[model samples]
Target: MRHFWCILLAIAILPGFCQALDIKGVHYLSLQEVAGKLGMKTRWIQQDKTMQLESAWTKISFEVNKRDMTLNGTRIFMGYPIVASRGRFYLSESDYDHNIKPILTPQLSGAPPGLRHIVLDPGHGGKDPGAENKSIGLKEKALTLDLANRVKSKLQARGFRVTVTRGNDTFVSLENRAQNANRLNADLFISLHFNASSTTSVSGVETYAFTPNLQPSTSRSSLHSSDRKTYPGNARDEWNTLAAYYVQRSLFTSLKARDRGLKRARFTVLRDIRMPGILVEGGFVTNNTEGRNIGSASYRDKLATAIVDGILVYKKTLDRLAK
Candidate 1:
């Protein structure tokens, strides 16, 4: 069987400690193998069908039959459920490659990436109001701009050159947004938006990076079109993924909202970015409870603060990688 050959190939090629298992023609690695790579301590809780991986600063918990795991209390999707084999738990090869590696070991590139200049995009402007919550009269455009102003101020305090694509209630096309950032020679690009769902109950923070080449987006509906192209944005896919995670975690801490997990999309703003880029949908505007929060000045300030906190973590990681 092809699967059997894959298992043989993995064992023959990988270091002895890996203990790789092939499942359905793909390889998965054992908890011990992953723990060794990440320098984390692993505890197997057989009764609860859980494995806890802890490091000096964080603890991550994974459970069988679940596609999602908790990273230091912030929920992150694994892209596929981890399975148990002969009392050892395994992480899917795709999940480890597309999800875990980027978040934990981001700077795989020989040269380190920096975040010296940041471009903040306030999604939808003059002509395009984007999603809106009619009950509270909150338009997505105004909210994003307000949040961008605060974020710009925050980033400036952190010693980064910060600029927004739109300074007022003006329209800026997606291509223009990317071009503006490129023109500025930005080191990072962050596009901000407020989400809306048809279902009123849906509310959470979602962060997105351009889908990697030969990979599908997190949402199934996007698969067909996403298969069409890859871009320069893929150059620093690892950095983009880690940056998204840092901000997603910080947003959870500041907003106390649901962690929707880091996602992949073929967003125009991201696809053409020569530098690392991410888009943040802070929360759903359609949800009445969250709509009010998104409309508040205090909440906008917190959003800015969360972004700054995330960027700080990302910069620190870059510094460590450079050394």
Candidate 2:
């Protein structure tokens, strides 16, 4: 019986399509059917118009004839609006699959339990210079350290106990950085770095969480992809995924930077962290314009503030869930 329902849910969750499509080419499912089928308790708040669903961990509110839905208080934009017909409200396929599914069943990135201590990792130092653009005199190692320091201060101001892997222009192995977070019992880990590419024109910010088990990474290369292995990092894949989303969203939205999309990678620093962790490539150092922006102290401050803001947003969501 469970297997049968699993197959049903699978059918309902296909990308760009919901459980069933009407003759009108609109894909949708009954609000009650979706909630009952998914084992979520549902109620109508406005006698018939507003529908609410709650699971053990998530709460979602929707309205008939409305294009917006609130998942745990976060407004989600849907491709199709809810409509009333045959005395039932039908939810759009895109909303159910993309916006609703991720929050309700966050297989990609689970929400964190709480936010307390955060470890900021500044990538590359000492003998290693990390990424650099000699044309602009910007070195990744230095920029990361600076960004980490500023982020640490901002996080501290927000009452989060913050620590950095490298506080100065010194060397710290990737292994040690992860170990340090485990040692401190940090709740979150964020590694900071600026990117470099041969193509100087390309520039943007992308964040990475550890590759989930059995899933190919976003940048999976036939040459470098490895057999699926569950590391300590994969244990917190949920938190890692959510944290990466927060970081990427916060940075790009506040700084008006390019969106490079969230990614999955198996960097040693992220692979071994016991807590939810992510690495952020802030921007392209090889780009003439962006490289200059990254080199600016004020710009680094903005980036740092945005990172902190993102963590706060992530924390706020978890805090609401706990309540």
Among these predicted structures, which one has the highest TM-score?
1
What tens digits encode model 2's per-residue C-alpha lDDT throughout 80-129?
56777545677856446544554455543344467899999999999999
The per-residue C-alpha lDDT of model 2 at residue 178 equals: 95
TM-scores, in order shown? 0.87, 0.70
Whole-model lDDT for model 1 versus the true structure?
Answer: 0.83
RMSD for each of the candidates: 3.6, 9.2
Among the numbered candidates, top lDDT falls to 1
For model 2, what is the alpha-carbon lDDT of residue 118? 91
Q: How close is candidate 1 to the true structure, as a TM-score?
A: 0.87
- Report the poorest 10 consecutive residues by lDDT, candidate 2: 14-23
Clashes (backbone N, CA, C under 3 Å), per candidate, total 0, 1
Candidate 1 deviant stretches above 4 angstroms: 2-18, 23-25, 46-48, 85-87, 107-109, 221-229
Clashing residue pairs in candidate 1, if any?
none
